[model samples]
Target: SQDQTWNDGGDFDGTNTFICEWDYEDALSASVKEFGGHSYYVFSGDCYTWEEAKRFCENRGGYLAVINNQKENDELYKLMLDFGYESAYFGYTDKEDESHWKWVSNDQSTYENFNKAEELGDVEPNGDTSENYAMFYYKYKNGAWNDGDFGFYTVNSGKAFICEWDYTNPTPYNLNDGNYTLHYTTNLGREHRSVDFDRTYDIDNIATERFTKNYQTDLAYILSVMASSAYTQGDLVYNLITLGFNDYSLFNYYDNPVDERYEEDSCAFSIAKKELSNNSTLVLITIRGSYGGFENGNLLNEHSDWYSNLTIWFPELVGFGSHQGFDAAKDKVFEQLKEELGGDLLKSNVKYMITGHSRGAGIANLLTKEMRDEGVSVYDIFNYNFACPDVAKRNFLRWNFKGKYDNIFNIGIAGDPVSILPGVPGDIISLGGHLIAQWGKYGNSYWFSDNWAEEYITYDTDLHASENYVRMLSNQKDIGNAKNWTQMQGKKVRNVGVDVIVKTTSAIPVLSGLNATITDTNGTPIAKINGNEIEYYTTDNIEINLNEYEDQTSISVNGKSDVIVEFSGIDDTNIEILVVSTSENQNKSETIAYFEAVP
Candidate 1:
């Protein structure tokens, strides 16, 4: 719409010919739009302190933003300068702590490009170093607004602030994963999954003998071979093929079943010599788990980041071995140790302690026992922690502690009951006579060496006093008592030559102390028991066949009842018998490597 007065031919005629209505409302509705692919906005009200301003912006569902790029900073500078908004509080102030200026929300610096001359203004001379924070001010000299740095301030000082937000990129997926790529995402701000080893050992054996000349010279080659075989046979395939392979490759120049050259962090000789000469008072001789070493086959490259003066001595022992044949394997360890270091290693004055975590503890216990059995005089053998199915053979000055929540040794099976006991019973009382034990967390148990001299630990009088220590129980269960019981009676009972006690609250079924007779074909009492029940215990399987005499065995209880069984006189075979006392309940099945037994 137009309202006009036209002048023509040098003559001015006011309100000449055409007139139109003019709407003044359109002029008031003009919206401010940004140009050059950018926009800007200034703080609207009176200035507030940095903290107050931050809170105000946060209340508006946004944070005090930081300038991420120069272009945005330029846009902000121009907008503020042109709009006559002189000095205003920006999000750049380091109110939390100065000198370590990081954005309160998304920390990024806008003054990284500030000139040296202007940088002097960023810090106040003789001011508190801890109170360095940046602000924005319009420079009257240059007619421009620039980000300025300042120090701590009082919250009451009102200052206008601009809130900048990140609009340059798309938002990330979630808070946990963070605004980073998957490959770069950090867990706990630490690179937890980085590989520790760079060298990898690939076992290829069909090569020439000339290539492995150096491997033949390695002193530990034979031990490594034996260890590898022991690992594979013991169902520690994961260790042999993975962690063991790494350690071996680093120390030796050969692959499995083959002679070859490899690399390690340092030569074994150097490492051993350094350890022996170390002046550190307390040396920790740790049996690395089947998978504790560097991966692939590499030295610990990043250890420098941990400590400068600490020395780490890693030994490969108490390695993988079958629990079934653990004693024999332990014997080998003792024999080999004696053969290698026999008198020399034992006499070393270095104050060192041996400790193992899980399976390693089993090996440590075995070695401790073997050392004692061989009459090898030793300073002290410390058994820190052990898992289930592990029995203390010979007493040592070792401490035994296990949690009651541990379950490694309690599991059992129907076919075999003796699988869980260690080795075979011997001529002496089992150091850990209570066959069935309740272990604590992770089935870790510790038997202190003090127990040997004092019979039992003074502090451990109740045995169950410490809930952290696994509680031991005899394997023998009163069958008559157990079968008739309506409730579980797990109370520990002493076995006095067959005299038994039954729970009164439940059906009291006790084993008969008096012995009955068992006949084969004609008539005879024949039952043979082997292995030590008090000392070292080994696994045993019971096979019962009812043939001649109808497989008859009689049991007579002193106070309760007399019972007898008869096998049908089927065929002409003598009756095979299996007799288990009330105390012989346990899992005795051995693991044939890794395959779970199929029944």
Candidate 2:
């Protein structure tokens, strides 16, 4: 066909599969393609959301193919030309901050395979906030990439997808042998390795020093400041890395393009994590606030986009609901996070530390409450919402989940006007402060020092700007630090313990809890696990059998099942450790990590 109808990804994803076109064997056999020591499994049998596709690929022992260069893209695109697929989901998306696109594998892809609007008539990645994930070779050719919705809206679109498996060159943590690549075992007992982390730490001295070591008290403020960057289009990797997060999912809808919602703007948030010594992870999710500017004619309200902020109300019920706009915004961010992180995994085994500013702050507050409602253990989440507005019916949590969200910490400027916005003005009915419209927020509140030297705050009207907040936080070392400022207890509104850091290269299977045990087989006392921390000891006795460290200690970290992480080491040399985990139901094995530390 010379002409094909172009459908918008936001068109409700109304698609159906009349018949199954391919099967697992078909995808593996004839559709199997190889490049750069990796395998690609192509299938046109089903159309799935970007998140669904990613999870499917991982379950198949790979991930959505992350095309790195033009050659790789061309190779796959050429083969796909014979098919009738309208589009396919890949491993790339700008879900984190709309400004900077990244691979799901965090490959740091420098190659751009975008089509020119002049030639193809469609600008790549121009779908704005509604479409964050990337779809491959849609309307035009040349392996062009377009920012697409999670699901391909049309019938022909998203029917084909490719999975990439790198058993040889697994990213972030790789152990290359002289003539070959060493292997390890994991959850599924060694099917494939992982592709997260930035490799910022020296693999050799992870025991002695880790880049993700510093767990600071002021981290909440620093990350909330970084959250402001999502309001603008920029790279967040470096900043998050500095904050000790080796792996993160940055989702942004704050890009200042003509927005999709006339009454309710989209939002942005990031889910990041750092590996700790005790085989545990410290997870932080930061949400971005209103992308505002003084040029928009509102000096006082930096949530300057007047359209979305103009109307405010609870969606359904009046006295027992959240603000429609902010609530929907929170749902969008949370859904994307669950879809990306895998819902069950996020709900269990992992905890969260959340922070945000302004609109993002409001959303984060509601999000924290929702996370609790949706089975994300309350003890597993701690939120810090800054310059936040009310997002719920005030008594929403007071009567039901009282004291449940005590970990939430909401901070704001003393006289910031936005805090009271949509105030008693937006709605004509003017219900009590406990009812709705920026009234219900779930957390403790505090005011920053009011006597900030005027130099820190650039404009009296726009003190809610992310930079200004950063400045105030800079003056006050602690986010909880507040002084002489009078509390405007007006109409009220609204909003994790990591035992050990175990870096796993493979996807951890679904489990109730991680049960850890150290056996006295080889060298049980070499590395000791404390409360959420690991302490290592050195034996100067050269007579001690260094060979004993190879299979010395065994670990079992799942409460209901047997998920094992075995550790081994060398004496003042490259550490050779093999990690394994076996799945009980699947009866399969996979290698989560294979470490060869070069001294």
Best by TM-score: 2
- Worst 10-residue lDDT window for candidate 2 reads 541-550
Each model's lDDT comes to 0.28, 0.50
Among these predictions, the greatest lDDT belongs to 2
The residue-by-residue lDDT of candidate 1 on 282-328, one tens digit each, is: 22232321221222212133221011001111110222122323333
Instruction: Report, for all candidates in order, the number of backbone clashes.
Output: 51, 40
TM-score of each model, in listed order: 0.23, 0.42
| lDDT comparing candidate 2 with the true structure | 0.50
lDDT of 2 by residue, 1-599 (tens): 35886554454455843334442132233346667888776655332245545655664458888888889988777656655555766788787787588888888777767667667767776777778876675576667877667544433334467778885432321223411111111112212221222333222223223222122234444545555544432224334544456566655432232334322445656777766665555677777665542231222232333333433545324544666667777778778767756665454445566777777788888888888777776566767777777665546447225666766766777546455443212221223221222254676666664565432221122566655566566553464345311333321211000011232222331111222334334534434433223343434211110110012222322211212233332222333334433222221123444555523
- RMSD in order of candidates: 30.2, 27.1
